[model samples]
Target: MRNRINEEITLRKLEVLLAYMETGNLAKAAEALDVSTVSVHRALHSLEEGMRCALFRHEGRNLLPTEAAHVLADVATDVIKAMADGIRATRQAAGYSADHMKIGSLYSLTIRTVPDVVIGIKVRRPELQAELVLGSNADLLFKLKQGAIDAALMAMPEPDPEIESIALFEDEIYFAAPADSPYARQASIDLRQCRDEPFVTLSEGFITYQGFMDAFRIADFTPNVVMKVGDIFSLMNLVSGGVGYALLPGRVRDVFAHKVTLVPLSSQYRLRQTIGLSFLRRRERDPNLLALAAVCRLAMRVPS
Candidate 1:
């Protein structure tokens, strides 16, 4: 006979179950959560007893979570996120709330997209307060996972179950060079040409860094690197001063139009970046999140 789960399942038990599911080892999960291994073991056993089902099985020194554990883990993330949102809603209704939207973005976006998005949001929510954060792609994602930021404007990274995103547009990457360089006058530059040129790039943590590296890989060569900067404008400044060439997106082209020239990368490179607004998928239906997403969509005016 199928057994019934305990009627009074606590959130703490679910949290433990998830920790075990993720680590697949009691000791490591305990270390991750800063709890005792014995406590972690007890929690897992209590979860099994409460559900009256085997959620894990012994595998040597490891406690391997079973299919049932994985299934519950899927629901656990949503349940935990929903419960947190629920508390916020209740507190807001009781007039004990922090009424501000926190947003994160890349430094490259501060020039246009981020400012436009903020303007659109204020138009819809005149009394709304906003807290903005600017960082590398990885940094913003870490903040989003920790609930430090409600959303971000960036090149959509790989899909993660806990995240939801709305794509706004595709921007092409170009070879940026000094205005007087021969490459500046080329209709399109061949990757073979880049083989010998010294290149400047954003640091490894930035999304643009990967795209730059990928383009060079397609050419079957490594760029002769001369310097790495933290921001795009600085990278462009290095290009304009003839420090080194860089592959950069077109969105920021206008800013350096006077001193630098942008040439479309060849078809082989096929480099492009997709900009989007990303947030926790669990908050997809959240009123405030939905409202902000709507503002992003309307302001962007992109097709579905």
Candidate 2:
């Protein structure tokens, strides 16, 4: 029956038949397929037997292909191409290699941490393209959990079973003020001293925002926050323009060094933010995530 014929005709046999047809000789076909001439001849013979047809005509020692052989060769080519495409599509759907990777991070990290990780990833995976999605710590963590990004670079969250983290470096929050402000001249500023000063802060979800609240809590009073911005750069801009003072991580000190001055907080109000890489525990074995983790591990060894 047709089912029995189908079972006998394997994709390997079709590949052999195509090779023989293209090369026009059993020896040449064997060379192309890296198989012995006898093996190539046997595969072609089995293919003809499965189809129950004379696909070639023997002209002395040479076997010339028949019109039926040409038709079958065309169909075999299409089948092989389709199967290859299907495999690629399936891998992409499973979050394997699709030639691109997405990484999420806090906007503050764009100054150093994100760039370092991304460059290292590119060095390890030369063909992979990377896309960066910047947002608050909570926004990035949400995106990481939803599978919208492969990984995130941000302040490490409290331990969770669903997430795996690799600590890269630690940064501290500082009192950020205009370059011309009196606080910028001091070796360190006390949060309690600024209790009555107007302040600008990043919105609720940012990692720096949490540090801001914690430091102020220790100082025992609420700051007079005049405005809340969504990003660190804008908040720094507001501080630079003398709209209000703000608290920021030390990471951005170099970025806005000329515009704003970051004065260290006194010992009582000092808070350290541990920055690191985070990904879903289930995807720990993913190739891209593995490469990213390796990069972070290397970074930990180097002085920052």
Candidate 3:
């Protein structure tokens, strides 16, 4: 029983077996492996002894595979390919060695907060390279899961054990409409006032979208959405064109300044979203990730 079991097979032996299987001759396998023919012979002999089976049969000075050898060859190919893939993945995760950093964020921040924070990061670490990827919040989250991005700016919800998050800042949602529209001139508007109005809103899966729904639910009203767009910009664009009103983050004021007007929602049902910088908790200790987190922490501080 002991003899039937192969001892631990080393990668080198697997390579030798694969090379010999390909070349069909010990001398040729040796040349391909950059080793002496005697060494190749010894490696094959050891493998055969461990497996208690003849891997190759002697046929007039040529190597021919046994049935078992053919089966093992297929397995070896898959194992080698998997090992190669792992190496490539590891290299990609390490990213560039320079002081550069790559960060991703939801579209809402792409226009203002993200740029301001990046400028702050550069001012502190001018030697660092900063790369930004902008996408819908859901898309950015997927990229973080795939390890394609190092960190992201997002709104927090329930706890995800695999992720770590630190609150960056909090901004309230406001009702927005075209500057010349009647809704814009109002000092405050009841959520019920817009309940029946045509509404343009963020698409599903965005934190803001959920917040909007929750706010309406609290007021015992459901917004009659006329259109659903993927990002804040599009939702606001539709509002600016007098298409409908929308619930948008306060930061939108900084970007769409004179294009739209904001009305403070009644405080009874005001919705606020907290934005944070998040990354895989397991990688929090990584030097590059840690440095990026530090920059984010500093950027979150309100200017005195």
Which candidate ranks first by TM-score, i.e. highest? Answer: 2
Q: State every prediction's TM-score relative to the real structure.
A: 0.68, 0.87, 0.66
Rank order by lDDT, top first?
2, 1, 3
lDDT of 1 at 71: 86
Give residue 250's lDDT in candidate 3 (0 to 100). Answer: 83
Give a tens-digit lDDT track for model 2, residues 152-198: 98889889898999888888889998999999999999887887899
Q: What ranking of all candidate models by TM-score puts the best one first?
A: 2, 1, 3
Q: Once superposed on the true structure, which residue ranges of model 1 sit more than 4 Å away at CA?
A: 1-98, 302-304
Per-candidate clashes come to 0, 0, 1
Pick the winner on lDDT between candidates 1 and 2: 2
Please give the distance, in angstroms, between residue 70's alpha carbon in candidate 1 and its true position after superposition: 56
lDDT of 3 at 144: 79
Residue-wise C-alpha lDDT for candidate 3, range 193-278, written one tens digit per residue: 77678888888878888888988898897788889987788888898888888888887786677889888999887988899888
Q: Tell me the whole-model lDDT of each prediction, alpha carbons only.
A: 0.84, 0.88, 0.80
Residue 290 in model 2: lDDT: 89
Q: Which candidate number would show the highest lDDT if scored against the true structure?
A: 2
Please give the RMSD of candidate 2 to the true structure: 2.8
Error of 1 at 294 (Å): 0.9
Q: What is the lDDT of residue 242 in candidate 2?
A: 97
